[model samples]
Target: MKAAAYRLTKIKGKGMGLVAARDLKQGSLVVSELPVLFIPGKSNDLLVQEEFAKLHPKKQRQMMELFDVNSTHGGAKTPEGVFITNAYRCPLGNALFPTAARINHSCAPNLTMTHREDTQGRAMIRTACDVREGQELTLCYTDPWLCRQERHEYLERMYDFTCKCSTCSLTGEAMRESERRRERAAVLRVKVAQNLAMCLEHSTPEDLLTEVEEALDIARTELFCEPTIPLMSERAMVLALLCKKPELAQKYADETVRVRLVTEGGHKGLERFRQYAKCPSSHPGAMALGVGSLPAESPDLSAAGRVVPPCYSPMSVVPIEGKGMGVVATRHIIRGELILDEAPLLSLTQLDANLIGGSGASIGSLLLDKLQRISPAQRAAFWQLRETSDSDVGSAARASSIFMCNSTTGADDRMHVYLFGCRFRHNCVPNVLGLDTLSKKNHMRYRAMRDIEEGEEMTVAYVIDDHNFTMGKEELDTLLEQRRVSSCDCELCSLTGPALARSRRRRKKMQALYDESKNYYQPGQLPKLKELISLIEEDIQSPFLVADIHTMALFTALEDEPRSDAAGYHALEALKCKMLSEGDHMGLEQAKAWAERPALARGEKGSTCEYYKPLEFPYVDRDPDMPFAVALRQHEEDVQRQAEEAQQKKAAKKARSKSKKGGQKKKNKGRRH
Candidate 1:
């Protein structure tokens, strides 16, 4: 009954069909309903029979009405032909809806059906274009751009009907002209896809703007309306963000929403673009590429090195004793001190799916284009990067290898070749740390994780995470050796003789302890964790691992109902370790919040967090040393007290109402006035 936008009517030669009840605009909701019958598999005659036999007589009759018993094409064989002709695919099955079954097919349809799960899994038919009153509502069973010959064959095979639509009925030169238009559109489609990929991977803001214009021109040539040309609107949004053009982004974002409503029924990515449209600068990648540079300060001299501009100083490029060139501190640098702030000279991203993994020509062109865009000085610096042992490689191979060795991937799947930053060589246990803070308006910056002596070559971990530390030593050594262009000569890697055996033994014991403690159920886990922490501290400066230990320690302390001070101390320790690691991930943020107010982080009596065993802790547990923690405990107490008072008042009022109702009922019964 809710599918009321159209009414069923008998149409000439087309059997029963749905016609628009009134004049309707494009993108207007026409009808939405759940399927009446559903079954798995395409040619499931058994399933149809079994399912039909179980249905009530009235439902059976309803299904019978949909199929013409007399006609060969109309379910005359087994009543399954009707379902085969009409049912659409859904999860685990094909679904048949009663009201929608009446809607006949058309090659040039005014309505389009989009299956949606957001509205409780209802399949919706919406107007693809404006429709006049009494006009038939139809949906094309195949792609509208299919050639006329193909459309005819597809329709005849699938639905037992020949298409006589406007495009299909054309003859002679008209038919040839339509085919030509389709052929041209198909060719342009590939070009448009390539352009979009290039824009995402290699184009500047200006290039994205050009793509938008070119796409619109192609769409116009193909006689595509605004709703049909989705890419033009999408590219405009991306271009707007890149150029910090919020208003333009919003305009295109809204257009995209409207177009999606007509064709796809909804767009899931709308929310992200909507937020970007509202404030383009709020996006993580907003204006990250080719923006104005930060102001440069004159080079400052320190004890052993000089800090230089654009690269930032007390840092200088120097050759290491056994390794290649690396960055070194001129002065003694304290922990957490910023080492350098630098942007890449050239950044490249992957090409589109169609262009990727083909001949190396497309990727080579992209690399050359990026090189040309940079300043001559920057280009010269990029060329000065040392050649590897491989020399017989071709131009494409050489370029790709250079990037593979020197470039680092950052946010947005971007591979950046830095003139200076890439010089900081790999150390499994390095003292320096590097991270891309694109959202913070700093593309990439390096900082000291520990105190650095003057004239020491600053190094960062090449494998950025703790995975290698977690692995067994032999496996880790094998994997690292395979990946290395040269031998790793770091303190841990260079060990040999009995010392190497002892080191491996300690690592094996440490990993075993770490594995046991990670489960939180091992006997003497606290003592074993202490031993693990001592081992890790002795081996390398892995603050990330320290942070995990402290986080685990906090939960372990709380579970034992230890003094809240000990819990708070563990929380603070974890927070400090995360800060030292220079990580701003969700885990670090949560740790920081927990350290600030331990009581709030702990669950309340009936809160949703109560069901989570990990979050369950005594709310009264408060660290007396932490003023904010004490304040949070007091606030929660007050809230709980207020909630109890409200409950009491409600109960009293209910009791009074019950007593008054009883007295009134007695008085109405003439027992007492």
Candidate 2:
């Protein structure tokens, strides 16, 4: 027999109530149970009765004893009433968890009855906070956010019980103070919403930082942190990145994960952030934080390297031959220039899901509310957005459709619909990069990767890895076809026949070489890294790919000597590659910083590397005579063979497509007669 952590006991006035058998820590599981009976959301009386009858008589009796139907209406004998009074609104529906239902309601509940599905599909109740032995466990029946009076009225009308918890029982000044704070929080929401927009669109980093700070202040004043923690965490990271403080950004990223664990609980949305937290440098521009200053000899490579020039603004929006409307250079924009810093017209995030679709409110209502708050000019700009084929037929749905279609998702899970940023056409091999300033909640910054001549069309990547330089041509084309975007006419995308085959072959060789060298930690591993570096150097067309390889090489080199100068060289090489290909401002700085002092990259002094483990490298544990070098060679040969096979298949597909097109044209000509 399974031993329970809690037991049901008769209380003086509250009928049967749950009492904790032992003390439990916060987040401890108190009960894991399946519902005795369930009424699939708002079922009719006949259906409810039929489901109830299907249950065993013993289980049915247990549920009936939990709630009294006669108390509401004398001798009515309503089984549905009994079930309704006791049922818990779980992920499934209204369910009668015999043990969970016995736990009485409180405005301030110690135990949070979350509807969590286990591997076996059983619903579990976990303690939100600590509960002492013999103390009565309670859960909130209605919204815990309601004011004292509102809670009283809600409880009276819905459950026919008056809440007398510590919060509800507060009297005099204490009660008034609590209510005042709640009112203040409600009022601050309008300002927070407005400022969030401003933060996204600010021209200067300082102004953007100011707006973010203001939002944080308001969130702190709210008293409850659950609603605003995610925003705060994201802002902290953005601030750190902007200020060139990677360590500080990492701290906030850790907090973001912690808060998500407590609130959202195992959400798939958190994985991207977790990866960022684990390796902040993996981000394109994140390396800039590592270096305090740019080298004197180094060309002004990014807007972050110096103050933005006055003329650096939206020069002109011009139509391209193949691509749609794109931002064009009016003057000679220097390498590492700030071309545009425009704010989003409309921004939507997962945080706004409830406000948009939950209960009485909707996306249209929320969009209207936000639209009304902004200036007339901003509203006009929003309306000017070119509606796509997916725009809804109706007004409300149309506004939502326009926003959704135009908006682009950022790292923080926000969808920002920009006025100017969206105009820049998509290119597989772009000369500029768009960076999300998470600190500002809803803003992105565009920086020049290289010097732009007058009349040149400025372009940014639509998908981060969806490019001929990064992904295979086939994969790139498939994604473009899905998005309904124009086929990329970039120099790299136009490769055909022998030229395309040669590029693919080089890329495959480089990939295989990288794979072979990345894992080995032996003394002989340096030779493999040298080979990989040589291959990367050979494929000089895409420096972005080279930078990533060099970064890996730098890490591998660091294992031999904690403060190896060789690692520093690789870092600088990687930085140069990144700057040339993607204008990675952060990567440039990080490389410079690492070159100056390699010790900082190695955790604290005397401490082991935080990012890598000795166990992962076989040299630390494996026998000295292990044939690590031979195995690596074998792996490289195998990878090369696979790459050759893949290339042959690709060639076959292209030939088939060409043959089909020629046949179709001939058939069409015959039909014209």
Candidate 3:
């Protein structure tokens, strides 16, 4: 109805073509119209003739006007031959739109076509990039990723014409280089697909990310714009779900939406990306990959007017009688509950004692230099922490002592100081568990080991080892005194003679059972290991120790019988305990897979176990969202809905055409009477 963006006209060598009547921007709709005839399934001479007869007389004339290269090139002059030259393959079927078919072919096309089944089988054409007023609009009929020689040969064979597009017309070294770039892109595309298919099984997230990046690099260099959209989307998902880097995930998602808008107009796919760009954790895979284990916010200290970010913790700093300051819970906290997840206020690497000039004074000066770069509010927070050094020491020495007292080892063995974390006092037997330093490099995470009542003091072990759990009351007190701490006063440490000795004996025996199980597998040891696990749970209630015992039991079960249900159950128990004790760690993904399918632990051949059943267990209490199975089910549902809608539209269109032809037949019969 409205003026078309392009006009149909004749070209000197290429017969009829569509040329832009006015300047058009990228993603602008060029033409939208229902196909003259829609043929369901594969197009053939018989099917095309049957569908063509159902079209209105005027629409049939329009279809006939479309050029048929096969007829002009000494081939059969049939409706099917014309359909082969013009029909666009879509989810609905092979659609033949008279107006869109006029757009000539080019190896490098400026226009892209999308069939919208929701709009009563409308064919929509949009410019992939800007086009000049007099430029001839074109679309690619063959696969755009094919090399130039392949593209030309296919075009000549199928349509009886050689493509003269700029990309296909390159000469000498330029032509060879273009082919090289395309060939490299093809190789990287295959590698990316293989890696993604085997992700977390044979390939790591890093491997997939690397191959995707290389493919994108080639796509951009070769000016192959279509592949960039999906590649960017994949990179964004991998970063958010696998790598657990929200900032980088958001960055790539935003880029993907922007590129898709220019290449393929707005669609439902872009809406998904927009939501992901706003908050990457909302992605379904984020829950499965434990993305919530990482800190939600990472502040930028480089910005102007930067200040110390407010802590989002459940505890408050309060003074103790002997201890200067300590954090206490304001509300009841559950076991495995994330108590504190905060980025470090300041981070400094531990000086290597083996360095040539490493000294106490040198370390103090280095610490002071790093301190000066932080914001003023952050610096004030750092100094407010308790300093254990003598009053006669210099400022740098006092700062170093405060750091030593408060900071904990992080990734790369660096010292990371947290404002709220440092306020918590230490107990030899602690109620909270800090994730291992090597697990997360950016943020320090602390989760409760056991439930605590409101107003209870939140404590963590400054150092946890065999001595903390296995030592007696007197010996433990002596060790704490040597470390410049007070005597044992907590519930476990306050035990006098008999209770303390029994506790020590149970812990020592538990450790011995764990060691024996790991050294060799024996049928007699299973009951002993299970008994020790129950004893530790009833007496110690230590998640780390429980996880260690379960891990040994899992492997022992496998060594006994690889495909037993006990092996799967123990693997799941071990995974759950590790998640409760350490949040997320290396080999966690593999552990999760093995817990779900124990046969994966054997080899590839074990995947075909007919008796195998996936072990089911609730995830850790930290995240309650749908796991991988539910997410996969949702994806399948969406695909099924699209297919059903396409089929419904096709059937409705066919009924309308049949009803119109029946009315025409009745009118002709009345005229004959």
lDDT score, candidate 2: 0.59
Give candidate 1's error at residue 29 in angstroms.
1.1
Clashing pairs in 1: 305-330, 307-313, 307-314
TM-score of 1: 0.42
Best by TM-score: 3
| Candidate 2 wrongly placed segments (more than 4 Å) | 1-3, 39-44, 68-70, 73-77, 116-122, 186-252, 263-273, 279-673
How do all models score by TM-score?
A: 0.42, 0.40, 0.44
Considering summed lDDT, which 10 consecutive residues are worst modelled in model 2?
Answer: 291-300
What TM-score number comes out for model 2? 0.40
Q: Whole-model lDDT, candidate 3?
A: 0.66
Model 1 spans > 4 angstroms off: 1-3, 39-61, 67-75, 90-94, 171-174, 193-195, 198-228, 236-254, 264-269, 273-673
Per-residue C-alpha lDDT of model 2 across residues 294-397, encoded as one tens digit per residue: 11111112223232211223245555675555667655665444555545667776777444445223776677777877654356545545455454433565
Candidate 1 vs 3: which has more TM-score: 3
Model 1, range 1-673, lDDT digits (tens) per residue? 5336788899988889999988888888888888767763343777788887877888777777775333654435445866777777753347877877888777567776766435545678788788898999887776555677887788777776887766678799987877776665555454444433233555566665765656555454433343346555655665676667767777776765566667656555345445544654433223222221211111222212221111124466655667666777756666655566666667776442123246556665566666777654344445555445364333544554566567766766677766567777777778887877666433566767777886787887766556345544465556544334455567877879999889878878877877777864333467677677778777876666777887676666555534446556667767766655663335455676677544435543333222222322112222222222223334557689999999999999999999999999988889653
What shift in Å separates residue 65 of candidate 3 from its native position after superposition?
57
**Looking at candidate 2, what is the lDDT of residue 327?**
67
* Segments in model 3 whose C-alpha atoms lie over 4 Å from true places: 1-312, 352-359, 392-394, 436-440, 466-468, 472-484, 520-523, 561-564, 584-587, 602-604, 607-611, 615-617, 620-673
